[model samples]
Target: MITLNSISKYYETEAGVVSALVNINLSIGESEFISIMGQSGSGKSTLMNIIGCVDRPSKGQYLIDNIDVGTLSDSNRSRLRGKLFGFVFQSYNLLPRLSAIEQVELPLLYQQIDNRKERAIQALISMGLSDRIHHTPNQLSGGEQQRVAIARSLVVNPKIILADEPTGALDTKTGLEVMRIFNELVQKQGISVIIITHESNIAEQTNRIIRISDGKIIEDTDKIVKVKA
Candidate 1:
């Protein structure tokens, strides 16, 4: 459902031009769970951003579900992102003032969808956040806050979910719980979930793992791994 051909991302650093992604070629299928693993300077985040439509590629073609993202207009790109991609972050980017329900509903505000509140409430409940519906970000625990972020992303019913270091901030136990949600989203909801992580243990659960180094894709293969949870 996603394709990238010789993709490269670059930035002008103080020292010189730095390449984030270097001539990368990748294809990810629908309903698949994949992990992008690399060290700090690797292009995992840059790759995810390009795939998620949060950022554009500096060169090469990016075809998301056969739709060439580079050719899309801003509104079309925004619509494509809303329709095809959900996003989770290292930090749960929830609004400090908005409750879980409101935060989830914020996306729909632009779509002119009816019954916004009820739909938002239902989405939160589906993510197992019903009991914490009225709580703001600070009122919830780390796991709960991340779950709220998950709910917000899923509420849009996007075809794919791109997560960047989703378990970075949480403890091991909490990180596993978050990954369990990702597993559920792929196995049950049939959403393609790609996460950028640095842990082999974490990448083991995914159907495939792609490793990047110094802006180039060094490994893209299916790995055999057990899922204890």
Candidate 2:
């Protein structure tokens, strides 16, 4: 569903150009569950941002279902991001004042979707937060808060779920609960999942593990050896 061809990202700092990603190539298929593992400064998050359309690659091509994303206008890219991607961040990124249900409704609100409240409630329920929908972020536990974040992402029915260190803030049991929800989305809904994580145990849960170092892919467990005709 996604392809990156010879992708590179560089920043023009006072010290001169610094490469964040170099000669990266990857393919992610529909319904695939993959983990991107790398240490700090390894460019994993940079790659995720490019994949999710939050940042454009400094060079090379990014194609989503064969459409060249590099060619899209800024407005178009935003629209594409809304249509195709849902994001869950480690920080939860929730508005401090909004209730869980309200947080989940924000995405649909932006899109002007109808029956947004019902949809948001359903998403929260799906994430096992039915009883906590009326609670604000400060009122919930870390895992519950993260579940709210996941609910917000799912309310849009996005094609791909991009999670950046999704379990970084949670305890082990809670993290597993979150991963279980992700697995369900992939198995039952055919949604693709790409998670950025530094934890080996977490990476091993996914169908594929891709390891990056110094901004380059060092290993891909499920990389196809040949291009399909």
Candidate 3:
């Protein structure tokens, strides 16, 4: 459902040009569960941003369902992102003031979808947050806040869920709970999940693991043996 070809990203700083990603070529099939693993500065998040349409690549091609993302205008890219992708972050990224239902309703509001309140409620219910719909982030626990974030992402019914260190803030048990939700999305709902994680145990739970280092793919356990730098 997604493809990256010779993808390279760089940034110019006071020191000099620094590369964030180098020739990243990858393909993710529909409803696939995949993890991008790397240490700090490994470009996994950079790659996720590009895939999520939050950032544009400096070079190479990105195609989603055969459409070249590089050719999209800023408005078009935003539209495509709303239509095709849902994002979850380690920090939850919820509004401190908005209630759980309100937070989930925001995306549908952006899309001008009708019955926003009902849809958001259903999403929260699906995440087992029905009783907490009126609660704000401050009133919820870490695990509950992450579930709220997941509900917010799901309210849009996006084809691909792009999560960055989704389980980072929670304990191991809570992290597993979140992973179970993701697994349900892939297995039952047919939604693609791509997660960026530093935890090996978390990566192992996914069907494929792609390891990156120094801005390049060093190993792809799904397709081949460990690749040398």
Candidate 4:
């Protein structure tokens, strides 16, 4: 339910203008899982930022569920982002002092939501962290902490999740478990998940893969061409 049409993002540098993304076009569908893969400086993160509404494209059109992002004001952009997108990062960006439940509740709390604790607990439970709700970041394993990050993202009940190298810090087994949770979020919760990763195995698990190079999408493949319903 998101489309990027003829988009370009550039930054002015002392050396000159540096283009981060160029002539990009993409449509992310509802209930679909897509992976954005590329080596460093390949524009994957730029694309993610644009999609996440954390930053606007330097040029080109972005429509999220048919709303033109280019036309939104700064306040509107942040508001729309909260309404539409949830974000998870590789760093497990949890507040050091907030318990897992508290971390999860933060999103809803910022939104001034009611009964947020109950919703936060349920979200953590969905991420398999019900037993660790009261634990702080220092108390959880890397994977558990990442799950807490995902729980926080889910607390707001956004339509999409943008995860960047979600498993980078975890051991293989734990990474797989984290990936499984992401897959479950897709299959069960029906969230549109867009993950940016360099790992091939992780990328393969997604429904579709979009590969980028030199600031442009070089490959977009639907695994199995189609999955049997």
Candidate 5:
């Protein structure tokens, strides 16, 4: 339910203007699991930030369900972002002092949602962290901590999840487990999950793969081409 049209993001550094994303055109539909694969400086994360409304493109249009994002005021944009998107990162981004349940509750707390505790607990339990709800980040394993992060993202009931290297910190087995959870979200919850990853194996888990290089999309596995015999 998202569309990007000729999107380009640039930064004015001392060296001159550097483009993080160039001519990005993409459309993501409902309940789709997709992966954007790229190397360092490939603009995958920039694309993610733009898609999640954390940043706006320097040029081009971004529309969500036919609403032009550029036309919105800051407050309205923030509201739309909260309503439509949840984010996960490789760092886990958990507070050192907050328990798992508390971490999951933070988003709902920001939104002033009712019954925050019950919702947070259910989110964590859905991520298979029922027994570790009281543990802090330092007390949990890497996979458990990541699951907590995922649970935090879920409490918002977002239509889309933008995960930037979500499995980067975990072991291979744990990474696969995390991927399985994402797949389930698409199959069962009908959430659109867009993950930015460098690993081909991880991208392979998704239904479609978009490969980017030097800030431009080079390959999109979802695109259909018909060749005449």
Candidate 6:
């Protein structure tokens, strides 16, 4: 459902042009659970940002469902982004004052969708947070807070979820629980989930693992190897 062709991203730093990603060619199919693993400053997050439409590539093409993303107008890009992707982060980026329900409802506010409260409630309930819907970020545990973030993402019914270091702040058990939730999203909901993480154990749980180093894809587990004479 998504394709990246020789995508490269560069930054104009005070020193000079710095390349964050170099010729990143990838294809992500619908409902695929994939993990991009790399060390710090290895361009994994940069790749995710480009894929999610939060940033533009300095060169090359990104297409979603045969739509060229680089050719879209800014407003059109925003519309496509909201329609196609939901995002989750390591830090639960919830407003301190907003309750779980309120946090989940924020996304619908932009779309002007009807029955916002009901939809938000259902999303929270699906995340096993029916009772905690009234609680704020501070009132929820780390896992609960992350679930709230996930619920907020799902409220949009996005086709793809781009999660950046989603389990970084949680304990081992909680991290595993979060991964289970992601797996369910893929298996049951048919959502394409692309997660960026440094942990091998976490990446192993996904169907495909892609390793990036110094702005290049060094290994892709899904690629078939050819035996040579």
In terms of lDDT, the poorest run of 10 residues in model 3 is: 220-229
TM-scores, all candidates, are 0.94, 0.96, 0.97, 0.95, 0.96, 0.96
Top candidate when judged by lDDT against the true structure: 3
C-alpha RMSD of each candidate structure in angstroms: 3.5, 2.0, 2.5, 2.3, 1.7, 1.8
lDDT of 1 by residue, 1-229 (tens): 7889999999988999999989998887778999999999888888888898889999999997688999999898988888788888899988899988899898878666788898889888887888999999999998898888888888878888888888988999999998999999899989999999999999998889999999998877753233422
| Candidate 1 residue spans exceeding 4 A from truth | 223-229
Which 10-residue window of candidate 1 scores lowest in summed lDDT? 220-229
Q: For candidate 5, give the lDDT.
A: 0.93
lDDT of 6 by residue, 145-167 (tens): 99999999999999999999999
**For residues 1-229, what per-residue lDDT tens digits would candidate 4 score against the true structure?**
8889999999999999999999999887878888999999999999999999999999899998899999999988988888788999999899999999999988787778899889999999988898999999999999899989998998888889999999888899998998888888788878989999999999988989999998998887852355532
Better of 3 and 5 by lDDT: 3
Per-candidate Cα lDDT values, in order, are: 0.87, 0.94, 0.94, 0.90, 0.93, 0.93
- After superposing candidate 2 on the true structure, give the runs of residues whose Cα lies further than 4 Å from its correct spot: 224-229
Give the residue spans of candidate 4 off by over 4 A: 222-229
* TM-score for candidate 3: 0.97
> Which ten contiguous residues of candidate 6 have the minimum total lDDT?
220-229
Cα lDDT for residue 125, candidate 2? 92
Of the two candidates 2 and 4, the one with more favorable TM-score, higher being better, is 2
List clashing residue pairs in candidate 2. none
User: For model 5, how does the per-residue alpha-carbon lDDT over 122-223 read when each residue is reduced to its tens digit?
Assistant: 999999999999999999999999999999989999999999999999999999999999999999999999999999989989998999999999998888
